[model samples]
Target: MAGKLSVLAVVALATAAVFPSSVSAQPPLPPGPVTMIVGWPAGGPSDAVARLVGAHMAKALNQPVMIDNRAGAGGNIGSDAAARARADGSTIMLATVASHGLNSALYTRLNHDPLKDFAPIGLITTSPSVLLVPRDSPLHSVRELIEKARAQPGKLNYGSGGVGSSQHLAGASFKKLAGVDIAHIPYKGTAPAMTDLMAGRVDLVLTTGAMSFIRSNKVRALAVAAPRRLPALPDVPTFDEAGLKGFHTDSWYGLVAPAGTPRPVLEQLNAALATALRDPELERQFSEQGSLPVKPMGVDEFWNFVRKQMPTAAEQVRISGAKAE
Candidate 1:
């Protein structure tokens, strides 16, 4: 019995020596609420999607996720704030095409580099811009619009949310590919741009789906920028189908955290986002709003996609002479 007791004491000492309390310690994950910053104003597509996905993310994380809207400077102001945030994974930016990838080339001086300053979490959704004209306008199709624009260079004007926006890039790409010339008219937002297009103040607008005004015959969709037709706009032909090969551009939104965030934290967030994206109700809501829900890919894949797109988008900005305010 004495020998057995001594042996047990030796075993306990060895176990404690091998496994210290510090060896098992792990820093606690953010216990409080996480904030999602949307660069666009409320009631926009980005805001709507952020709120929808954020709710599910909150449930998966077992914490509340609040939305912060900071709209200005073509999404630069809010994006800069996100990039400057601490690398703690507590603050995330709901970044769009204008703020993340395109701004690098469009702006002469940026507060942050999209590729180096932020760690990509995952892609959320893509809202392809559609080319549209007034319903009563003589331009019946994309080809017709191009031909008219070519014949009357600088006579036709196109409306966009603003310079350096996805809308502007799409319009510029169309002009370059189709070999047409038209004046670009910049507006503060898509709503005002669409309004001007309907009022005949502008000849056309390459913008998001016009579902609300479609029923009223306010505008006519000429072509969709996606590879295939959207379900909501089945009658509209894609740019490739409309006689412009390899012409596709869309405003995509994704999740991004400040640079230097832990890899484990990013992976966990990506997994949660993937689960939220798989929800049926989320898909339905996105479709109803004329946006497509993109399945969340791994962090590396998301980063690769953004990196590959930067040069092409940058060249478009250069060619379009888009500038940041």
Candidate 2:
């Protein structure tokens, strides 16, 4: 009995030494101001979404979250900056559809890889594009636009934010699916594209629903590139309903950190974002802008989404003949 008791005591001590309680204890997250990099100018869809989510993220983290707009080069300037930033949790990016997924396919010689340079935090929201034409223009619907383009091949011109932007891809997708010939006019940004579309300088523009012209009726919404009709514009038909079946394109926003960021920090940000997504006020605000709040997914899911989207976007870029220069 004495020998057995001694052996049991020895085993307990050995176990305790090998597995200290502190071993399981997690260190508290580092403290500092967190910066969200926006790859576009202020007041744009990505900027607005970043500001909104950043506000909630700041509150959740108990630290100020600042939005730094580093716009240029079709979102490459800001994205590249974020990609090269230190893996410390302080710097993250609000990556848009273009920077996170489409730019790889669009730019022939991109400086960084979206998948390799950043760790995805989570998906934030998705907003569909609205096809708009001048109110006084003869085009009344998607069918009308298609008919016009078919009738006058290579005559109808459409404007986009840039060569590889979501607007450009949406327009190109429409042309391919609808079998119409149209000229693409690349502008500096969506605002400028919308400006020309409203002025009747361009025949059409596929822009985000946030465009003032769409709400003010300066430009008429001929169709939306979504699976279903938006609540804000119930009367406007989706491209699928408007005779372009299987047509869908959305402008998505997500959070990402420089690769090699700590897993705990990523989890913390994802938790805060999940909480923010549940807030009713934020939901209402997002809905007003035609954005749908997406459920937060883990790093793997976000990466999976990127992988699935990049190839399709690349194919679209090839089909559209959209070049970086």
Candidate 3:
């Protein structure tokens, strides 16, 4: 009987060891606010997720969490800053698919190594891109839009938030797959670009965020650029359904710290992040915004996921000829 209890105790300790929380009286994280660097402007999905997770993490860790926006270069600007930050627990970055996966492939040169410069925390949320056109447009389907673009060649124009943005890549990929010569129109940001798209200034937009605009009858969603149709937009077909198979693209966000952050700190942060993400209210909030909260994965597992995604990202960048400006 005593031996069984001893074995059970060992098992308990081992399970608790997975996270740096106070399982065995482990020391708490060091003092001061934890600065979470978001690589996009506030109110965007990444920023919103960061704030939500940060709010929960602050309470769990008994430390304040601050959001610092360093928007530009398709998220590379803030990513570079986070990579160079001291290898301490005080600083970390909210990395998006653009920053970690696509930017490395899109740009010929980058100041920091996406894989080598950051310690993997875990994924936060994933939001897929959608195909949209002005509500009153005569185009009713992806096939029709493609036909028009091919028929008109460079006369049709598509708008994206900026160069090297995910929207740009999606549009580029779409152009390549659909064999269309639509002129690419780069906007300073998605807001103005979306405004123009709605106002018929641009023919189409490979937009992100929830399907609220679609539900509100503000825009017509032709297709979803995802592996499957979104539950929120069940009527919307995937690119595959539109005969543009395998044209999946998504905007995802994750948490990462400097590469050399102590393993214990990483474990603790991972714990706090996992806990925060699993919160019911946070999950609901993410869903309402067309973002899905992903479950927590181990640090190494997250790294492996990033590693596996590199080749595909590289191929997309090459095929799209997307480069940093």
Rank candidates, TM-score, best first. 2, 3, 1
Rate residue 289 of model 2 by lDDT.
Answer: 79
Candidate 3, residue 205: how far the Cα is off, in Å: 2.0
Model 2 TM-score relative to the real fold: 0.86
For model 1, the stretches where C-alpha displacement exceeds 4 angstroms are 1-29, 215-217, 319-325
The top-ranked prediction according to lDDT is 2
For model 3 the TM-score comes to 0.84
lDDT of 1: 0.81
Tell me each candidate's TM-score.
0.83, 0.86, 0.84
Clashes within 3 Å, all models in order = 0, 0, 0
Model 2 clash count equals 0
Candidate 3 residue lDDT tens string, 1-325: 9999999999989987775455344333568999999877665556677898899889878899999988777777888899999777889999777787888778889899998889988877888889889999899999899888878889888887677777889889888888889888876556667778878888888867735667788789999888888877788899999988888887777899998887788888889888888889888877766676687888888888878877877788899876666
Best by TM-score: 2
